[model samples]
Target: MKPYLMIALCCGLYAGLVAAVEPITVAWRDKAPYHYRENGIEQGFLLRRAKHIFALAEVPAVFVERPSKRIWRDFERGKSSYCSIGWYRLAERERIAQFSVPFHVDPPHMLLVSPGARATVQAHKGVATLLQDGRISVGVVDGVSYGPALDRLIAGSANQVERVTVAPASLMQMVAANRMDYMFADEADWEYLRRHEEGLDAIVEQRFADMPAGLERYIVCSKDVPAQVMTRINRAIGALSDAAPGD
Candidate 1:
């Protein structure tokens, strides 16, 4: 059993002159319409896109499921071979994880409140105004990013918001229950939640008057992942985009 023998055997298993690509463990938390498990099947827009890209690139992927916090932690370590399907290229996240090209582009983040809370929220220009007024109790998830403007506002005035250390879906439930005055969610996530959550009719959508929406989401891989794999994934993404118009 020498070096050449191992390569020869692996190529035989793969057939032709194909070289075995290292498996990338692509993990994601349950964020519906983007990433979630339905009937024990991994499904969502980004998940499907990632799977397709990997397949087209001839890259083997091992997908894992986790809560938001663990996904953040694992993606930071760079020792575990875990990558995520959809994550923003926040200045903070970019420091720890190497990101692939964009696969999904979402609309700006908006505020969601119970209908009763609407009068108060509407009085203000935006989340920044509400925070400046120090009157409303905005609910936000602990590990998620709400883009730059809101992040700066909320961080500066921490007491003005209630932090929910739970899933995004629960954040909406809290708003509906009057436990949280409101929460921040992008259009896609809010759309998915509002349809399924109880008492969601009470939720209100607030377009951000404060800041513009940011960049598209990148397939976030731990920095430990090989550069070549990311390149292959990006190329596959481009291929899919190229093929879409004629289909």
Candidate 2:
């Protein structure tokens, strides 16, 4: 065979191999300091880490913004090659999807108490006592988890719970407006809201002595995701250092 013809054939084969690799769809929601769009570009610590992990694994990925409910729905529908970052590993979720090794550790959660409910909230000694009190109402975001321990506590609590589908910042605003007595907020989330959102001055940040330890977040994907792909992702996560700030 001619040398020029051999080179052309090799080039064509390489192109075919590259074209055969399908990019995974990485779904994310709008959560500042974690995952959000700024200036029409994706930005956040978790998002950056995810991108790095995928790159290190040599996996092709395409990020798309979607609502949290929709992300979970895609998994429920058995969507292939779909993944989402920074989700808790829960039993029900495990039944529906696969999870990677934990990639991020959040700080302990704090309570955001409404100004009007300050006196009432202060009366309780800890999270347990506070949740058991039916007098104080709590607002929770729908389809969100506060880790297994806290989630169980919230479920078993006698407190009046109001579930809403809103961003954490908007939930803080609801607290300021006295929509509910208090709600759980991630330490990092509170920091971001405190610095950026207005009308939060009246909102009181309270810490309980019995609050559960911070939960680890993982890259959750549809069950159809290849085990080999997950293995690569997990290996990449293991190789990365946890020294990144705000993680």
Candidate 3:
């Protein structure tokens, strides 16, 4: 090959090598509008913002997806380099992961009950009161953190609540099937399910006013991520011009 052609080929190879550098494996759960399928593409407030932050960090990335509990399990077991999008800054999570500053404060997880069960939930004063009353079984996803206060409430009433490891879709299916009395869901997840789930129309909504706020989400990564990279990610997050609104 000519000298110029040789130089061009070398540059192309270098570019490819850089682009192919091991990406931070981002673990995503199928929960919207934080992370979910839309028109067969991944799109959500958190996912979109995460993409921009990752790009600004100038790192290659790949996504691995699973149900909520498994997402955390896989991330812990090395199935993914880290996880991006929609992690509430719970104490347990902070212990194991490096989390970016708040990307957004999401709607507090609310009481989602079936239409017929509406009377049952409403009969109680609030979530804590209802759980303490124990007239009904509350459904919750296994690994999800319902903020600090709600976690305490659920922990206090573990017998009254059922914890299952399933995808958001299946969780709604359970409620629709009346297999579980109710589950704690955010507004975004409920809205997404409303469009796709057949029986989600029967799901009723209520507030947890007693639950404390600061249900903010952050980009959480495994311990192995380089300090510099995390710093860059944090910086990128801070500089984002279009942050998703907080609750």
On TM-score, the leading prediction is 2
Return whichever of 2 and 3 wins on TM-score.
Answer: 2
- Candidate 1 differs from the real structure by a C-alpha RMSD in angstroms, to one decimal, of 4.0
Using lDDT, rank the candidates from best to worst: 2, 1, 3
State TM-scores per candidate. 0.83, 0.88, 0.76
lDDT by residue for model 3 (10-123), tens: 999999787557688777777776777878898776777778788887877877566667767765675436665678777666677778777777666776786668887788
Q: Tell me the tens digit of each residue's lDDT in model 2 across 1-247.
A: 9999999999999998875488999999888889988899888989999999999988899989998889988898899889999898899899889999999888889999999999999988999999999888999998788999998999999999999988889989999999999999998788877998999999998998899999999999888888988999999898885444433
Candidate 2 Cα outliers beyond 4 Å, as residue runs:
1-20, 242-247
lDDT of 1 by residue, 31-133 (tens): 8988888888877877878888889988888888887778887766665566887877788888888888887777777778776778987887765667665
Ten residues in sequence with the least summed lDDT for candidate 3: 238-247
When superposed on Cα atoms, how far off is each prediction in RMSD?
Answer: 4.0, 3.6, 5.4
- Model 1 pairs in collision: none
Backbone clash pairs for candidate 3 read: none
Q: Give the total clashing residue pairs for model 2.
A: 0
What TM-score should be assigned to candidate 3? 0.76
For model 2 the local lDDT of residue 11 reads: 100
TM-score of 2: 0.88
